[model samples]
Target chain A: MAAAARVFSEKGFGGASLEDVANEVGMLKGSLYNYIKSKEDLLFAVVRPDADELLMKARRLSGTDLPASEKLRQIARVHVEIIDRKLPYVSVYVQEIAGRGISQEWTDMDREYMSLIEKAFMEGVEAGIFADDLDVRVATRCFIGSLNWMTRWYEPGDPVRARAVADQLADVFLAGALARSRN
Target chain B: MAAAARVFSEKGFGGASLEDVANEVGMLKGSLYNYIKSKEDLLFAVVRPDADELLMKARRLSGTDLPASEKLRQIARVHVEIIDRKLPYVSVYVQEIAGRGISQEWTDMDREYMSLIEKAFMEGVEAGIFADDLDVRVATRCFIGSLNWMTRWYEPGDPVRARAVADQLADVFLAGALARSRN
Candidate 1:
């Protein structure tokens, strides 16, 4: 699956073939078919687990007893860590090639993930933690956009640097870059 | 050029043919070459002006005497406004298609625009307005990433809703969604 994920990220889901995945893993094509039924199945194998894990983690966080701000911080940290850990899968997931309709699973996962974040913001607004005037939907988009884009630029292997980025992102999302009470 | 921009955004630069662009404008392929030397030139024509304009406007804002926050606000407004006004153009410019073997013009424009924003954030940090701990480059990337992804989701028309989105994005970028203080 990891090999397939890298192939899909590089060649795109539609462009990647069963042979490509097999070659990636140094296996014969027939041998690969024993493990996966088809190319579409390979895509699902590579992408679904990542999405499921993200959705599960996000649900757990949103369902937590912690404050909204704290939840959001944890959510941001987890999001950054996930992207760092699964850059290949996440990159392929975000690309338009994945939207070509081999499976409805990706779309379903995306919509649910978005709604979960939206619900988090709505709860923040309700609890009077986030500003009342905050556009929860748009703010959710901003948050997701900022986090999702990490795959485009972030490189793994630097855990310290990656953690710093995640911390700063959570900080910016919570308190922003402007100093509190400007002089 | 507008037709070409739309075609490029939809089909991608490499995937799009001169014939497709020509057909988009309802022009004969032979006549299209009179205006453009090749497909790459068509891409440059469609994307370059928008990048140039953004850099020009951002440079103008950065050079102003306005505070960094105010400048950022205006820049954000203008950035969103530009994306709103030229969705098709902006969409194509940001796509990987534009990253293909185009002229150096697009590359230079992008760098200048990023440097301008980075400089603005650096100024804010220096003036003790933005947080001293801020990583200016990553922060600038965050800002650009937030603003750039708007092209993926923004719908044309409805100026009021679009303006609201722009304002909220700038607000979030500066102050975030959390209430004034930690409770």
Candidate 2:
């Protein structure tokens, strides 16, 4: 699957072929069929587990006992870490190539992930950590935008560098979302 | 050029042809040849002036006498309005299609724009309006990322809504960048 993911990432979903995946795996095309039915299935294989893991980790972050600011910081850190750890796979997932039509799963996962971030903002609001009238939806959207846009520019992934970026993002976003009195 | 921009936006630069541009203008391809030698020329025509105008406006904003927060607010407002006003043209410029290979102009324009935003951050730092030790480059990149990411989700352009979004973004971003004492 890592082989397939790399192939898809390097060649793009539309441009990648079953042979390319097989080549990456050092296996012949005919033998590779035993593991996957088709390229769409390969794409599903590539993206689904990662999304599931990301969603799971987010749930854990939301349910943690930490303060809202700390949680947001950790969330940003983990988010960037995973993005770097998974590297090009996240790149392909965000791109959502023509085969994005193959299923609605990606769209559903995206919405769920977004709402989880909103949940963090809401919790902060309830705790008096963020502004009472904070536009949680807009704030979360912009927050996510700032992080996700990194995918466009952050090629040649380095886990340490990504961690630093994560810290910087969290610091700024927390400032942006803080209760007026807290600042 | 409006017709050509629309055609390029709709068909995509690589997928689009001279015939498509000519047809978009309701003319024969042969007649279109009198104006543009090639598709690359048309792309240059469409993008250069919009970019030049955007840069000119950014320069004016950098020279403003407004406080940092208000300046940032108006910058965000004007940024969103232009993206909305220009709609798919900004979209195309960001995408940097195959024809993007034709020149380094887009890359340079993008760098210049980024630096302009950084200048805004520096001015705030110098005014002691933002944290003296703030990571200006990171802050500016994140700020621009927040706005540019809007283009991905903000498909239906409405000036009023774009303005509202601008205000929200600016408000939050200023909150993020404000000095500790100010808060």
- Which number leads on lDDT? 1
DockQ, in order, for the candidates? 0.44, 0.34
Model 2, B1-183: lDDT tens per residue? Answer: 888788766655655778988887789999998998988788778877767887788878878887766777887888888888886776656544311233576667777777888887778878877766567777777787787767666755588988888898887777752334442
* TM-score of each model's chain B: 0.91, 0.83
Task: lDDT for model 1, please.
Answer: 0.78
Give model 1's clash tally: 0
Local accuracy of candidate 1 as per-residue lDDT tens digits, A32-148:
978888876777777777778888999999888888888887777777777888889888776653333435766677777778888888888899988887888777877887887
**Fraction of native Cα contacts reproduced by each candidate:** 0.49, 0.39
Model 2 TM-score, all chains together = 0.80
Worst 10 residues of 1 chain B by lDDT: B94-103
| Interface RMSD over true interface Cα atoms for each candidate | 2.8, 5.1
Question: Model 1 in CAPRI terms: which quality?
Answer: acceptable
